[model samples]
Target: MVSKKVTVKNPTGLHLRPAGILCNEAMKYQSQITFVYDGGMANAKSVLSVLGACVKCGNEIELTCEGVDEQEALDHLVAAIDSGLGE
Candidate 1:
């Protein structure tokens, strides 16, 4: 398992489109990926789960993954968040 705290940079945070991107990326890996916001954990592969978390900009979220591509998957998600989800 790998975990990293990522700060959401997108102004609107992970909204519908970016959430789709996140879910799509998460699906590429076989890892069981989850994003933790506050005290709750949401499945990264679900767009609804992500939006429901309300991860606004400047919010720190912990991304965790368990499986073969855990590290890589975490890295990409971190990068995506850092990229402002292409605001």
Candidate 2:
């Protein structure tokens, strides 16, 4: 398993668009991707799951990936989030 802490940089938070982008990115890997936020964990490959977390801008999340490509998945996700998830 691999994990990293990242803060949401999108001004609007993980709204529909960013959430979708996150889910899309997550789907690119075979690893199980999830994020811990607000004392809860949400599947990164599911838009609904991410949106339901209500992660706002500046909120910190611990992204975790476990599977064959865990490291790569974690790296990609952390970079994506760091880049504002294409916001």
Candidate 3:
């Protein structure tokens, strides 16, 4: 398992569109991906779950992945978040 802690930089946070992007990127891997925010955890592969986590700008979240492709998954997802979900 691998994990990355990131502060959300997007002004809008992890809303529907960014959640969808995260989910899509997550789906490309076999790793089990999860994001934890404010003590709430959500599967990264589910847009609704991510959105429901209520992560907002400047909020810190932990992205974790466990499986064969954990490193790649973590790298991609973290990069996505670090990029403000390409806002």
Candidate 4:
């Protein structure tokens, strides 16, 4: 497993649109991905779970990935987050 923490840079944070995009990207991989924030964890492949986390701009988020392609998954996700969650 691999994990990294990033700050949410988007003003809207992980809402439906951005969160949905994240879920979509995560589902494309055959890896186990999860987002951790506020002492809670959510599946990165679930839009509802991500939105339910109530993340906002400037919040710190930790991404944990485990599987055959963990590194690639992490790299993609880190890029996504760095892109302001595609905002």
Taking all chains together, each candidate's TM-score versus the true structure is 0.93, 0.97, 0.96, 0.96
Off by over 4 Å in 3: none
Alpha carbon lDDT of each predicted model? 0.88, 0.95, 0.92, 0.92
lDDT per residue, candidate 1, 14-74, as tens digits? 8898898889989999999998898699999999999899888788998999999998998
Ranking by lDDT: 2, 4, 3, 1
lDDT of 3 by residue, 1-87 (tens): 999898999899989998898899999999999988897899999988998998989999999999999999999889988998879
Q: Report the C-alpha displacement of residue 36, candidate 3, in angstroms.
A: 1.1
lDDT of 2: 0.95
Number of the candidate with higher TM-score, 2 or 4: 2
Give the range of the ten consecutive residues with the poorest summed lDDT in model 1.
78-87
On lDDT, the candidate that comes out on top is 2
Question: For candidate 4, lDDT tens digit of each residue in 1-87?
Answer: 999999999898998999988999899899999989996999999998999999999999899999999999999999998987668
C-alpha displacement of 61 in model 3, angstroms?
A: 0.4
lDDT: worst 10-residue window of model 4: 78-87
**List of clashing residue pairs for candidate 2:** none
Please give the lDDT score at residue 41 for candidate 2. Answer: 99
Q: TM-score for model 1?
A: 0.93
